[model samples]
Target: MEERTDMPSDPTAVDPYGCGCTECLTGEYIPLERATEVHIADMLAGRLRNHTGTTFHLTADYTIEPNTTLPELTPERLTITCPDHELTWTLATPRHRPLEDHHRAGPSLEYSDGSARVVPRHRLPS
Candidate 1:
């Protein structure tokens, strides 16, 4: 599907609604990890702004696969699906913190046909 021209292109410019993360709550966007995830979630949210039937699926694995070419690196990704559009962002820089407990009540979630199930991947139980 074609993109909406009326939508804002810059993700950082967005001040999201009631972000519960420490980074957004405290406004202490630290060097990496937490701060970075906040940005990513906002960015994904921006892309899905006006699209109907949007599904945001997050993953627990932030491992970047081996890559010799800096530009062609395959890192962890955040994917968004809409009724007629899909965007998968390959994050060159993912989490630096330990994968186990860094993020999650639902560390990983799987989605198909709009149904979701939490995948407990070494995450903090909620």
Candidate 2:
């Protein structure tokens, strides 16, 4: 069963884009630059072990998706672990948000079921 989340509201937000998809938040029209969409759609990461940094093993693969049957105060979508660095992070996908106008021009969600690509083993640490 799909559950509705009790999302926090930002009193200062002014949204003007949305695509009426079952998986996407609805949008309106706007003349503002679309850059803000990335920041808004950013995954909320929660550190579980060591601190976060870009200096992780290049081979450290990560996945992000919700795999729960929610009863959550703060929903966790997925976890990413860097075994080499002994570091971990949990992430939550965006919800109750609006999609940008340009998003409708192409794929609804391109990486919906995609894997991340990184350099091959030849270039990564052993």
Candidate 3:
């Protein structure tokens, strides 16, 4: 994948269709996780964006590992491990507020086909 420095970092900016529920309003909400998964799914589905343009029909062989638990947070934090490579990310609830629903941010992801790739919370195209 080509690197584009101008890519948006905010999840909402990249994915317009959020988790579609209250599960996304707090910290790394379900909406965010779903959005992230959608991106990976798109990649696997061969739906690749220009990374610099609005064209959204690219193809690539990809795999997405669901969120796993990080050793640091143990049973509290939501972490996902990618067995394909050495990468892990933690999802925490918004500061001070507890998750209203069972919703929580899924694990952070790292993709390693040849290079290391971290899927941003946003930047997932529909």
Best by TM-score: 1
lDDT of each: 0.36, 0.27, 0.32
| Among all candidates shown, the one with the greatest lDDT | 1
Instruction: Arrange candidates, best TM-score first.
Output: 1, 3, 2
After superposition on all CA atoms, how large is the RMSD of candidate 3?
16.8
Which scores greater on TM-score, model 1 or model 2?
A: 1
Q: Which residue pairs in candidate 1 collide?
A: none
Off by over 4 Å in 3: 1-75, 94-100, 103-126
Task: Give candidate 3's TM-score.
Answer: 0.22
Per candidate, the number of residue pairs that clash is: 0, 5, 5
Q: Point out the worst 10-residue segment of candidate 1 by lDDT.
A: 28-37
- Candidate 2 — what's its lDDT? 0.27
What tens-digit string does per-residue lDDT give for candidate 2 at 1-126? 875454332212222223233222322212112213222222111111111222422222223347632222122133444464454443343342222321333112111233211111122344
Query: Once model 2 is optimally superposed onto the true structure by TM-score, how far is the C-alpha of residue 55 displaced, in angstroms?
Result: 11
What TM-score, over all chains together, does every model reach?
0.27, 0.19, 0.22
The local distance difference test score of model 3 is 0.32
lDDT (C-alpha) at residue 19 in model 2: 24
